[model samples]
Target chain A: MDSTPAQVPEGEDLERRAAELHDAMLVVDGLQYSHWNRGVLEELRAGGLAAVHVTIAYHELARETLSRIGEWNRRYQVHADLIRPVREISDIRRARDEGRVGIFYGFQNCSPIEDDIDLVEIFRQLGVFVMQLTYNNQSLLGTGCYEEVDSGITRFGRQVIAEMNRVGMLVDMSHSAERSTLEAIELSRRPIVISHANPASFHPARRNKSDAVLRALAESGGLLGFSAYPFHLRGGSDCTLADYCDMIARTADLMGIEHIGIGTDLCQQQPAEVLTWMRNGRWARELDYGEGSAEQPDWPTQPDWFRNAADFPQLTRGLLAHGFSEDDIARIMGGNWYRILEDGTQPRSA
Target chain B: MDSTPAQVPEGEDLERRAAELHDAMLVVDGLQYSHWNRGVLEELRAGGLAAVHVTIAYHELARETLSRIGEWNRRYQVHADLIRPVREISDIRRARDEGRVGIFYGFQNCSPIEDDIDLVEIFRQLGVFVMQLTYNNQSLLGTGCYEEVDSGITRFGRQVIAEMNRVGMLVDMSHSAERSTLEAIELSRRPIVISHANPASFHPARRNKSDAVLRALAESGGLLGFSAYPFHLRGGSDCTLADYCDMIARTADLMGIEHIGIGTDLCQQQPAEVLTWMRNGRWARELDYGEGSAEQPDWPTQPDWFRNAADFPQLTRGLLAHGFSEDDIARIMGGNWYRILEDGTQPRSA
Candidate 1:
């Protein structure tokens, strides 16, 4: 259920304007880990989303990645008012125009890439512009941010970055190790991204970035997608939209406007079954066979970010109230990322 | 070791220019989680950082957070050429002007608040402008992104948000949960922030925020900080600077200009001991008793983003290559954040 009308302090007029603007915007969320279901898609529509980057590489997803994509495709047809599977920039553009959300098929880890460079292109052709070389655990690429022994990016990671660049796929370093992130940034011919992580300025856990790292990313022309995980913020679980906007402003101050964008890594509609599996540690475990040892502890499971995706408008209203300009709001909402897709996803000229 | 310069591609000139610009830049990384040792502080100066947000609430920083602050103060005095502990916004400004890397006192978790509302003011008075309500685990305020069970903001969290507002401290939600983040946004009267984290456009892990989340943040007139962790990005560990910038640009396109800033969350100066503690789950354990199991199993352990803090120029060069405007670049490089700090840290009218 939506927040109570009594709880919604925004007047009906503000709500109306917010709804109008949200409806007109071409919104594209980079990552949505939620399980696909009618309720989830409905929430997407209710939130006025234009497109979403869906992940199909978690352990549970590993077995049925392709089948899930097909299922979503069928679902898209059934829910034409709400969703459209995105396969390219054109698909995203078309979806934005038609008021249908474009579904971009992306993998959270290479469990599906399964050590094949060719699969990288295959996935890219299927609309996986962004790909993380590793997941929570270390893999053929390198150690993840949560790992204890971080040796840096591995040889496989080098190959993956190269392949990703060759295929016009965007390489994400959100959960990667610090060494791997730095190495990837310096090694990739194309600009890479830390699509979803927090600044080390505020928090120093494995979950955030350092000022030096942000500078390195900015210098490399990579984008730092600011995240809104509550624990990472100063206010903990009690943070508000002003908190999220404050983060955006701080990131913009550090990375500059042209390089800033929004990547709210939401898990909408994914059922408890999947979330439960995530708690069990299969998702990160699959990334590294060695990490499955008895000594290695599983990820500390946690509740999913909002229960679902229907609450996007609240996010919009929050940003508007935080003092973001209409144009800047549009860019952060989707335009800056649209440019990235246009430039980064295109095949390189020989 | 740095990448082989002998393998210098045709873009060597660009690299040189980036390095020069980065060196000349009044670069101020928002936070550092390194142990307050000479080596780390030296590294900060080596990177030509104008200021660094030194942490006083990491794992090993237990009960001794005040000592750590005092240590930074002493170090700043001793390393006068290299560092100066900052206690106010103006102090940071002075550090930037003086060519000495400013040392801003910060806390990764509000455990330092130790269940006291007035401590918020005490810390703020001590130059703790940036504070994360929780670390990797939950606290009295709310849940951390890594907690197995995330309860939205507790009553204490609500009070924390309000107190932060009353005391003129910037609220950071980088490690928080969605419910808490949303709640903080709604509860706070001032512009709150998620200082660092990736855009949800790519990674769907708990650590990242959704596009809707970032949009909501921008809508609320707050800022979304882009981060540097790689796993949070699309292609886990293989991300590059271009991809990073793309994420930022995406947010900027959607959220508008003023709602963006850099909270780089740099942990460059952290000692190996601290890294070990952070990686060993001590940080989160310290925050929440009886909790602090390993991070989600799917999440990788600690992965370093870089060897140290000297590589900031690489990020700047990459951003310049990506076609970011100079004005926009300046904003991302820290101009916009200064404005936000001014707005967020203003003294509340009693």
Candidate 2:
């Protein structure tokens, strides 16, 4: 619960390298939806994070999503010393160079596009770099993982993927159904991402990807940002950093070292109501437990080793201990995500 | 194909009584979602329909549904001579006496309520008589017929049903999945209606009810409005009047005549886009060929015997020809619907 970074464990000699590696890396979390404030902003900087693909909307429509973007614009204005917008992929490098945490916009659901295909470009122009095909239910474009059937990419989904490719909006399928996710990988012209999910081989969860989907994603040149959210981990909140890093290593062996990275799925300092909004939206008149069970129907506790943004450095230390090479560690930390963004988030035709 | 009523096959005298029977009875069609205009209204009047539960929204949100209601309000003003809004159950009698087709507002989907439980009362106050829990896909309330699985009645669904019961909104489960529909029948304190569907025994379509559901519905004192929509018929557009009536007769034997009526899910004089809007709302970015397949995705042809609202007399003739007693024919025509609405659509507390 402490905001301050805990000191590196045991040997003072080993601490030097962990601190140096954390400082050297451009730590980019592929997804986080924390309740943004000046306090949360400070934590990302403390964690040595260069860029983060933060969720701007879950089930919001175009106009509502625009309002959320405006709110973030206000945050950028107020916290100029700590944060800047990643309008272009280069802005991330600029933030890393200047020591500000770069904020890149992403949608957890396709609601921001509504039914208008034109909004894909409009949002890309507005600096939204990543968009998932569906959140956790069937959407206009494709079926979400929570749905009964996995009807693959809809006709509109096919067109939207093309538009997202043209406009440089990276497709994210973190919460989409299996067939839809597989089809999205095959369908997208550019590399897609499962922005924040662990492998089902790591933890057989509804939200996790199959070995087949992960392999297809890697073959299609996609990135898989390993989720640190406990429910997707082997032992839920009790999952140790070693177990977490081990899952990443196994996933790397399957997906190739170049395709793996840490997303964490951190939702720092969010109220219970925000959790309700994300789970239920306007779709349910009743409570939808979502990833949580009825008895455990609130946000699950994040693992102690990875509680908030400030705990991100622990991931670097844990990965090093798990025997990944320095270059692989750098890529798994942020280098791979940065490489993907350089090509993926640029207007190809425009 | 003709607008004028054709002679009841091989019996001129039977045709005269069919007209008289249609005229003498209330002749309420439980559901109709035609693209309303002066022409469509004229057809309802020609059919001698005393009241019609007309769909005002398929997948419209609260504000959108309110706007739809506003559009209907405009129709009441423009077509006052031919039609009037049915605010109360007794409004049906008033319209019957006045020789105008009473238009009762209904929603084919629960989208109008959005996530708010209070909108159930708001819509009821606006003269919205019926609201289906789901259209053809999973919703916040319940699973639709098209979903691969059915997790019956969400927490919100239970609350919405109770709110509906308190506020006098008739719960209609015409397009919900089997478990959701069955759960709704058992859960609802008041009897629910399947406003537009046939027995699975007749057609065995996805949208049709099973004998188990139909029997439970009848046992619960509910009603089943036989849909004349061709996809729900045994022989599609070629189904004869005798075949249609025989299906009804078999259903009547199973369900009792008092629990049956006509819905004739008519979509008259509308462009193909309306069908797209109904089948695939904003939820589907692609064209969802609901009820119709990819090859035969457009609106299926209405049977020749029941092509339009003006063809209501043909149903009476067919039922009479099927040897239903005059009392049973009266019940099947409109009496049953009127009886149910008398108690089902009044706010119990109010």
Candidate 3:
């Protein structure tokens, strides 16, 4: 629980050097669930984000999820200059070249598919790149991180994974339990992802992945996105930027640097009511305080060093100060995510 | 138009014989858009309907269409005794054995899929057994009957047809323009269907199929369900039972008897506003009277001989008096639809 920032090179030249490096790298955020608007898109552009995987569904059924997608479609139409929808890896490059942010859709839960397996392809065709098998509780597909018993993937879940593999939708296990996450990594033919979770050994949060799951995920060529959410950090809002970078470096040592990237679970500008909806969704009659106490069931305060998309450059500075090379910094920023996405988002050969 | 009833043996025994024949046959109505409720389900059972392909979408996008399916799912749960959802052909036999009506969902327009071709399989997995290519106007897939210029199936429509064929959803072209209908039949690898339409030669209505389309449909092993809609009838609401039977007999001659079956197109007990929604849906600012005049924009009055499901037996007797054998009557009633359903509702081998 060390909350102090480690000493780093304090010259203005070093700070300017970090900013220039951040501008040069193709930075990508693996997951973000922000209150999207033109302002948010502009902020992402300011942060030099080439692409971001945005969560559009947590517990929404097919109808509600499609409505959310329609809303995003409208946003893409209106903010054509600031952001564009991402379907292929080339779209990310185009975003970088155009100096805009590419918004890639992801689902934090499998609720959007409901009871039908074919909806996986339907969502993929609609440009959903990543889909988690479960959220924070039990789903039809598998047990979630908050569930007491960790039952592996269900029979229908296996069928869904196969269909997802066939359609080239990347399987995510961000909020899945240990057993379920391990099983999904083994079962998916293509490389899976933990789009927005840190190593449990780093902070011991229920939403974090265990070392065993991380080893399997890395061995299978999957990606682990280091989360910046306060609850998943070591010292909540008091955790220092230097400490966060150190954790990322440690994780890179455990699971190779190729499998490590940033997925700052940023819930920027979302109202507190949305968090309640995310946790309860229509399943619970009572408020389920997921990661927070009943007395304070709200989004935890983000550390000042990483409060929003605009603060992503601070992490690049912290990593550079931690003695990581410019090449390693560039890979951690977005290159690794781009490589995994290209490998995972194409349909399997017949 | 001939309005006279054909001569028949006048006796209680002949009346008893027709009733016995109607009850013995596997009566299937290929399409109906009734205000579904327990009362309507009871009437369907009373008519000895083993299965009825129910219209669930017209100009609805994906979200609205999924909501409609959710509503039907609720109906199936609440009225389990009177009706059950149909998926496979065996569901029809199960319905007949359980003495409940099998409700097979279909779409009168391809709107449920919106712009995504993968939704074809998604809707099929949701138990939508049939999906028409268009309604009374142009769609993403093809041109409808009411369009002045018949632009046949588009490029995306071809992909949708292949997906629908692979997923076992019957491609319906009942309300499509002639050229589009012909193109759909030609492009579909599996047998396509015109789930509800009469011959244009029989009535010359804009919504009716042409002789060339019917010939192609039959030659491709597709079924054309004869419509009982007054607008498509020769004499509107005054059409006689004998004339309707003769139209069926003539159609059976044109397309083989194996390709002709009843589709009724019955719109029983629906409020007039629903008709406006069907014709307008979100696309129009002004109401579009599809078949009826603007002054009388309402559901057309059903003919006296076929006012509701209860009047099905009258048509059975009329067919018998038209010199059709008992075996032919049985085939016309439901056997033909069943055979085609079995062929068109199973997924094609990879």
Candidate 4:
């Protein structure tokens, strides 16, 4: 598919303002499930992203998830000039100052902890900062977004939330069922996040948050990162940059500006098999397509305006054109997430 | 301290009757933390115990706990003639028929699960049937008996209870604080159990259940397995078999016959170092003599009449002499526990 032209105001002065603002701000992508390499790291650096929450586990078990972290550790060592590991909010600033992307770790599912509650601290110490209670099916913690019966959080799920809160891990419920998501917002002592999901009123995808969830999230000081994943967008692959920013504006109106940011859900440079792995893991023997159907058992094509990390500035320019103030644009781009990361990643006092 | 004599009727005919009843009944000890060997198994067999719930994890993490389960698996294979792993209630019957002790696994704390909720099922599949929400300090699940302020069962604790209920694992709150224990009993969909604890009204130990907890336990269809641990007994090492039986009778009066059984909490033949391991694990750097002070930083002396598994028949004699009916004696001997085991260990139907 042909890449869409950047949909900004047709003037060099406006472009310079957007470019300068994107360059000066601490751009933090709330989530991305990309196949990371030097190319992806270079694109993130090129996009002026100071930090990005990278999905390290979908349905991987503890051992496998640890191996993925080990892989990222090696990447940080090898690509020291392009990327750094994010253990705290200071690391994001350090990455920005050093002209490198801070790669923060997250799990799209609770699979990595597998049933052990102590691994929360273990993973937190290893630089995993965010974990979703469920992915797209029923986990020990709670029901996923796709499950017909939503039993909310299980007894074990409640324990996990408290432990995560105590150990400074941000509880993400992006792919959890509605009841589970709402329950998590109510149950977590610390602020939670939907790291990468749109509003259901805008897109109506199963992965999107409801109006009630968004409001509760704001009340609990949680953040909701609007998704750019085509499946979660209002117009799928054809979603215009203008319409995407308008959706963000609408979400900001509902959730307040501080609770909104960009997660993008970018899955760049991944093979179709990786989707199968993400959707099925070791839990299912047969293929489970998750958000895709049997005939479309692969990742949907990303919208052209935000196809890769390098296209991030397009969002900044689009937001500017869509009439968001520079301050609001900066916060929506990363400032809000930066504040949340600062608050969410500290050990709770006894 | 000299061992106390068995406080049962002296007549040889009465002794024979107690022995026959002990041998004939399905004698299930709700909890035991013995240093397992062929000798221990022999003692259990000599006592005519058909099954025993064994503590597998105190404060061990997931990897260490899994190693413990592996150790048990090897033991089950090597000592196949003496012991069998109990995954289901039918296994208890099978062990009895085969003249072997059914070893059911339990955790004295939720450490094996650590932070992940998924491990509840994984551990259940590996033969863990009972799990205490806390040991003697605050865990992710709840406040332990040693913690001053009980915050009740945590949000995570509630989730864990539901997962445990769904997967057929019994929620044991024996070492949890009062509020946490009560909350767990109330929160659990399936009846919870105090797998090894005594009534606080009888002993007044920090580890014993309050009268309110006991009443609630009975009302909620839960079971209380009386602990014979010195710290939980009314008079410590000086607690007479008669006093113990009287305590049991009192508890039965409060909780009804169906809710009373014997856990024993027998730590037979374990070295003082083993107690250190149980009390501290990797959590404490300094010596933590749990239930013991600096002056008594060791395993307390066991009451003579209940020193080891082979002494179990003395309890049957004691209860019989204490004026319990043959039917009540039979129920207290193991029948009550057997019924709870049947009810507590099975996947909950949705």
1 or 2, greater by lDDT: 2
If you assessed candidate 3 against the hidden native complex, which CAPRI class would it receive?
incorrect
Q: Please name the candidate that would achieve the greatest DockQ relative to the true structure.
A: 3
Model 2: lDDT of residue A252? 90
Which 10 consecutive positions of candidate 2 chain B have the poorest summed lDDT?
B1-10
Q: Give me the runs in candidate 4 sitting further than 4 Å from their true place.
A: A1-350, B1-10
Give DockQ: model 1: 0.01
Over B199-274, each residue of candidate 2 has an lDDT whose tens digit, in order, gives 9999999999999999999999999999999999998998888888898999999999889998888989888899
DockQ of 3: 0.07
Candidate 3: the clashing residue pairs are none
- Give the count of colliding residue pairs in each prediction: 231, 3, 0, 25
Docking class of 1: incorrect
Interface RMSD of 4: 10.7
Question: Candidate 3 vs. truth: CA RMSD?
Answer: 13.7
lDDT of 3 at A93: 92
Chain A TM-score relative to the true structure, per candidate? 0.84, 0.96, 0.96, 0.96
The two-chain DockQ for each candidate, comma-separated, is: 0.01, 0.01, 0.07, 0.02
Per-candidate TM equals 0.45, 0.51, 0.58, 0.53
lDDT digits (tens) for residues B110-220 of candidate 1: 777776565676557556787777776777888877778888788888888887887688888888877777877888888877777777765676778877768778777
lDDT string, candidate 3, B204-265, tens digits: 99989889999999999999888899999998998888789889989989998888899999
Q: What is the DockQ of candidate 4?
A: 0.02
Deviation in Å, model 1, residue B243 alpha carbon: 63
